[model samples]
Target: MAPVSHAADRVQSLDVYLNACKIGTIVRTPGDFNAFSLDPAYRATGGTPVLSLSLRAATGGLRRDPRPLAGALPAFFANLLPEEKLREAMEKHHAASVRPGNDFDLLAALGADLPGAVRVVPTEGARAVASAQAPQPPRLRFSLAGVQMKLSVMKNTGKGGGLTLPLEDGQGQYIAKFPSLTFPGVAENEYANLALAAALGMDVPARELVDKADFEGIPEEFDTLSDGKVLLVKRFDRGQGGRRRHIEDFAQVFGLYPSRKYDGAAYHDIAAALTMAVSPAAALDFVRRLALCAVTGNGDMHLKNWSLIYPEGDGPPALSPIYDMLSTVPYLPADGMALTLGGERSFKALTPSRWKAFANRARLPEPAVLAAVAATAARVNAEWWHLPERAAIPAAVLARIDRHITLMLPILAECGAG
Candidate 1:
């Protein structure tokens, strides 16, 4: 790694690697936008160990071109970094060196530990451009794309089982999501929601709500949030011995920028993609998760939330495990879903007819889709009340979820889910 350059005119370029093999180069154009081109050797190998679904052409070949990256990194790369408050926090923490909203520089700073197997490093003579003269702090050199303040921490194998920042060259095994000032009890809410999701037979990652003090390296401000607890979820893309599997979110698949995660695509689009690229069973799993979201009032399942994991790092894609499943209605009672379902966005609008309509549009069998919805609804109604995790939720929030499920039962019952 070269010393951070301060020259305004110096070209900024990064080598993109997957599984430690260089695949392409992303260059910050003279116009300040980014452009990427495949490395000749990697291109000759026929795009093995797939990088992203978005990078594939409609003919099922890699799309090879270079153009202005539109004031940010391409959607796939852009979605790899944190957003909103988390991004602001990182920028503020490294204010003296990294610029605010500069995706290229952010990637150079934290690329070694991005989600999946992809890693970015500055190309020789093309280094990250820093601004101020103040000495910078140690880089928080891992990126997890989301607005929430979370850290990619490694679990200690000692008796107490604490979590801390990954040691040099070590990978984070769990994602520790901290309590948020804006959303109280989110950690507990998510624990209850994930418990319900797992009981409903959705494939969810292993998770637990642990004391915040058990986690080290969390910044002071986030450490002092709503409660003394944080949600720790095992990383699905990582395997034993820290082997990396590749993954890309639906936003990357559809080539939509992260800001447009709620637009330019719908739930039907995702189902259709699953049916086409993955298996019919994968599509059915998606339907079940969608039903879970509706039953739990999880309004934040945007394109970025749904992802495809390459099981073998070079293998075909499958739906990743359920994550970020908090009941948002307790926070914003009027909020709708992050993406539309059958042209409707309201959770109250979920009906059997809508499921049928969605099945028709998504090219899935209507009966299978309806069966998934019924199964998910039945499981939620049956299992949620008995889950011990529900006791951890705040009383008011629990009551809100109770009311939400009660209101949802009628529509689900019409599908014979009750």
Candidate 2:
């Protein structure tokens, strides 16, 4: 097990990496903000940068000497760590009870493996993982991004497509998500939803449902799901040979707290974010994604669901592959959309006129936006009708989705999408 460190004073500086190559450094300043600066070596030989180290492209854009970031840490660094609730398993089984809200401290504790290549340890323990290649003891502990409970495991090319092996301290190429005990068949639902998105030409990561019984050994922590299937999603951020890709969710990019992800931001704000941080071409992709989300009944596409991927870490930014796509309307009939569209919270109110007005407000080409909305709605509706049986979606869930689509047909027609 990795030793947990909470001494905020012990951390002085953090080295950041991209694809296992050093890119920058973060210095600690207790009781104040953390300071980050691009490594002079990295900045000197920079070819094409994607990560954008901060919201400002150049150090001159920031008034601070070293570009001190928000949330007591850099926005990007804070995003590397998962939501507070998502770390319960790590705290309960592996670490100190004291909740060190400081992200630098948490990064110090889990030094060996993290989401991206931006690995950090105290300058002293930074070289602590020399024996990382050795096989580790089996344990029922894990750390993953997002607020959901998930574990990182692997499936090799052996018999039965290889049994699920917990990554231990090594990085995992696939993330295993257990079905929600309170909501039966959620794993299957997410798998089917993601598969549908991929079929619709959305850039989605590969995912599938793995039967729990296929595993020769099941961890005790996952005993509640022994009778069902678990969703295995390929981590888009991690690639072949354990290389890590950089990514930032909308919440982090906008400098909003996870608690305020839905309360403060709307869909247009996301489009506007793309306009400023990325290019107009990338903004058009957001249009198709938003339109598809409307037809798919994925009402829970909150700020955290959308992300900007830095393929080369310091290269140009593009929309990240979609994940966490599911029909939330079925489970929470009482809940509405997580964020508003064109100041309209009611999905039924999104008429053609409303969308046209949204396009004008977001400064996107009205014709392109309209065409994308009409085309995507038509395509997704037709494809959704044929997905239930093929994806093995539960009959009851399929029925709800069918009804949900029916409910949105009139709305789509009002928008001249039919």
Candidate 3:
């Protein structure tokens, strides 16, 4: 790809790599928009690394011409940057490389350690193999999506197992999520919700709670915000010996920008995508998770929270392990789901008929969908009712969860769950 001269310091084009194989170039067009084009050889090759489902054509080949995206980077690349508070911190920390509100410079500054196996680099950089094991972390060179304040950290191998910042050259194995100043007991809420999901048979990632003191070399600003503890969640995208596995969220799968993550999509759209891109079984698992979220009062299951992982860095993607689940009722008393389910957003409106409607819209078997929902509701009822006191759930949050479950019972019974 040839670069067109726009400005002296502006980046004209970026080379995109997936699983360490060069696949395409994101070029700056004359209209001031950025567009991606797959490399001819990479597109023609068989069994190559997968970029994204949204970019793939019906013939199973990468599309030659995609609509140019507005702004400095395409939607896929823009979704890779940190959002809100974290984005501001990153811009200030790497001011020399990234200008405020500039997505291109931000990607160039920390391209090597993005969320999935994909990396976007200036065309002149050396080809990067994502699976190569580096001894140290990339030294605050990584960026994770979402508005929450978190850091990529590694758990120490010693007796105490303290969490430490990654030094250089590698991705952090865990994400350290601190408490929120505005929302009390946020970390504990998520921990309890995830625990309940796990008990109800969802494939959740390993997680634990750690004191702020347990973190070594954390930034000073986090100290002033939440309480003295944080939650440490293991990253599923990294496998044996820290090898990178490719993944893409629903936002990227639908080719939508992060700004529109909660809008323009419904639960049926998600189920449809799962059925088409992954499998019927994956879509059914989604129904179970959706029912569980409703029972637990989790109102934030947005597009970005759901993902698909390519285990072998190629085709046949599967639903990713659950992450970022929590009860929003404690914070928002009348909280509803992030996306509409069967023409409704209220958890209380998720009746048997609504689920049936969702199944019909998605072309899934109605009987299987209702069964998944009912089974999930029953499991949550059993698991939460018998949870030990040692779970340390905040009093108000636990009470709220119990109240929501009770509210779901009458409706759940109609769906064959009691």
Better of 1 and 3 by lDDT: 1
Sorted on lDDT, best first, the list reads 1, 3, 2
Q: Model 1 over residues 211-322: C-alpha lDDT tens digits?
A: 8878777766335466646899999988899888888999988988889988979999999999888988899899989988888788999999999988674467899888
Specify the poorest-scoring 10-residue window by lDDT in model 1: 1-10
Model 2 is weakest, by summed lDDT over 10 consecutive residues, at: 91-100
Residue 87 lDDT in candidate 2:
59
| Runs of candidate 3 exceeding 4 Å displacement | 1-12, 28-33, 67-70, 125-139, 158-161, 221-224, 313-315
The TM-scores of all predictions, comma-separated, are 0.92, 0.83, 0.90
Provide the clashing-pair count of each candidate structure.
0, 4, 1
251: Cα error in model 3, Å: 0.6
Tens digits of per-residue lDDT for model 2, 31-99: 556887776666666423434434454544332334675436665566656665455545433344224
What candidate 1 gets wrong by more than 4 Å, as runs, is 1-11, 125-137, 159-161, 167-170, 221-224
lDDT of 1 at 2: 35
* Candidate 1, residue 328: lDDT: 92
- Residue pairs in clash, model 1: none
